[model samples]
Target: MKITGYRCLTTQHDWGRPVGDVNGHVDSGITEVPILVLETDAGIEGVATGSTHDVDRLFPAIEGEDPRAVASLYDRMIARVFKSGHAGATFGGIGTIDAALWDIKAKLAGEPLWRLLGARDRYVDGYASGLDIALDDERLAALYGSMAERGYTSGKLKGGRDVADDVRRLRIVEEALHRNAEHPGLMLDANESWHRKQAVRHVSAIERELDLVWIEEPLRRWDAAGHAALSRAVRASVATGENLTGLEQYRPLMDAGAVDVVQIGAVWGVTHFLRVAVAAHARDLPVSLVGHTADAAVVHAAAAVPNTMPTEVQDLGSPIGVTIDQAFQDGGIVLGDEPGAGIRIDESEIAARMAGDGWRSAAGPHVRSHRTGLRLATERTA
Candidate 1:
């Protein structure tokens, strides 16, 4: 079936508690989920529930083409924006379209995406990540305790600003996950809020009290040398790459032995994950899937990849009008036999709740504080 056109809409994922990291938090615990629907001439439509910006510029690349040619169309989308570069929103648009195309392809084959992607098993292991910097102690414990009850044996906490506070919070998560596993996996995300030296010191201090599995985004996304140095200095594995948009951005870090766990964001689409997972596998590095709300599509890709670590579990539920044919059980995501990614969007329900993101707070975590990186200098002088 040939691609005809696309439609876009916005929905919301309510975390039920404030979610944020070192940078900012959404006090209302709600964030907007962008939905993309690719219409086909033969009455088959593909859906993607993530960022779908810049479609006006990128759609022409795949227009009138067979959706089954997902990879070629993906490359075409990238090449379409060659001069402008595919990073931020442009890459997001490509990722969403690519995911929809893959969805259509799998639907056409009359198989679930994991099966079509050659995965023998439909289960994708996951770790609970609360993005809980904004949550209070009681709320944090409640959030993770619930995940533990769901059989998650690992959890990642967002922290890096205050070492003492981070240590305390990590202990809370450890205690929560301990209900499922004796030695539950623990991780900390600095969210690119710390400098290289600051990362070393902060993580080193936390290591004194906890055995962390990894520390994510300790430095900026492109700091290959700094990440390598930080990795060498700390015992916990350094994980980055969530903010990176393409394969070329990962090469420098891979060559430098910078990242121990290579992370591929779910928002970047299925093709991107497949390519990155293969590349990371060649280097013998473990790949992890960064979670997004309604991330089932990429989880299918994660299941087919041999090098995947536990994917992140950000939200336990779907947006208001979206339903996913997957179960969060056995400490992971189990896919249904439904064709494609198994995400069904109810346009009427979405229209009824047509609320734009109301979680807007000027001082929230979404806004990076002015003193974010500069504090490293202040700490050194003091």
Candidate 2:
């Protein structure tokens, strides 16, 4: 069936705890996440969220097109945006549509997205994130102490401003997890707040103390040499790729042996997300993905890849949690046998929330962190 139409939408919800960037540069947080819907002539529809910007312009390229020709359509869309300087960024929109197309494919096949993609594990190991460096010890304990009860075995925290403060925050997260924190899978993200030397210094001081899994965006996403340096200097591995738009950008980082773990998502789409999975697998490195406000789309993305576990989750208690049959258990997330991404898009609820003025106000078309600089760190590079 051909594509009929699409709509870009946003919904706002609270993090339940403080939301902040890595490095503590911006601790206060607000939410205005993006979503997109692609409808087809056959009454099948595909939905994707967690940042589908400029989805309106995508209709012209894919409207009246076959969703089954997802790869061809995706390539065409990429070529269409190549000269306009939006090809990479548009993939956020294109990736959503690509995911929707994959949903259509998997639905027609009567299998879940992970099965369609070739399942690695029905459920992947997950870690609790959404830990704000800005949170004081008491609030930190209250949040993560509860997270431990929710079945998370590992976690990452928003960190980076000061090395000493970063260590202090890490200690608190460890304590909150109690026994689970023993082999602490805690990771830190500087959100690109540190220069290379500063990242090395901070990680050096805290790596042994907390035994961090990785240091994310400690230097900068693009600084291959610097990342390699920091990775060499610290016992903890250096990781990035959360904000990269395509594989071309990832190669240099890999070439430099710049990262020990690769954290990716919203880079291109589930298609490229899988591509990143393949790339990481070829290199024999560990990979993880962004987990926030995602329902089934990301669940399938994680399950289809091996060696990628403990994805960063936004919350266990979210309004969107009810949209799917999958649930978090045993420190892992498992999906059920539902066609497509298995995401039951609660359209009415989405519509209600999209009515931003009523229950809550959406952030904006652009990504915004309470602190201005944090937004720049995560923007997709052309």
Top lDDT model? 1
In candidate 1, which residue pairs clash?
Answer: 24-365, 25-365
Q: Lowest summed-lDDT stretch of 10 residues in model 2?
A: 357-366
Question: Model 2: per-residue lDDT, tens digit, 172-288?
Answer: 777777656466578887677777766777788786666888888886679999999888898888889888887778889988899888878643577778777788889998888
lDDT of 1 by residue, 112-145 (tens): 9999999999998999999888788898899999
List residue ranges in candidate 1 displaced over 4 A.
356-361, 376-382
State the local distance difference test value for candidate 2. 0.70
Best by TM-score: 1
Could you tell me the TM-score of candidate 2?
A: 0.87
Q: How many residue pairs clash in all the candidates, one count each?
A: 2, 6
RMSD of 2: 5.0
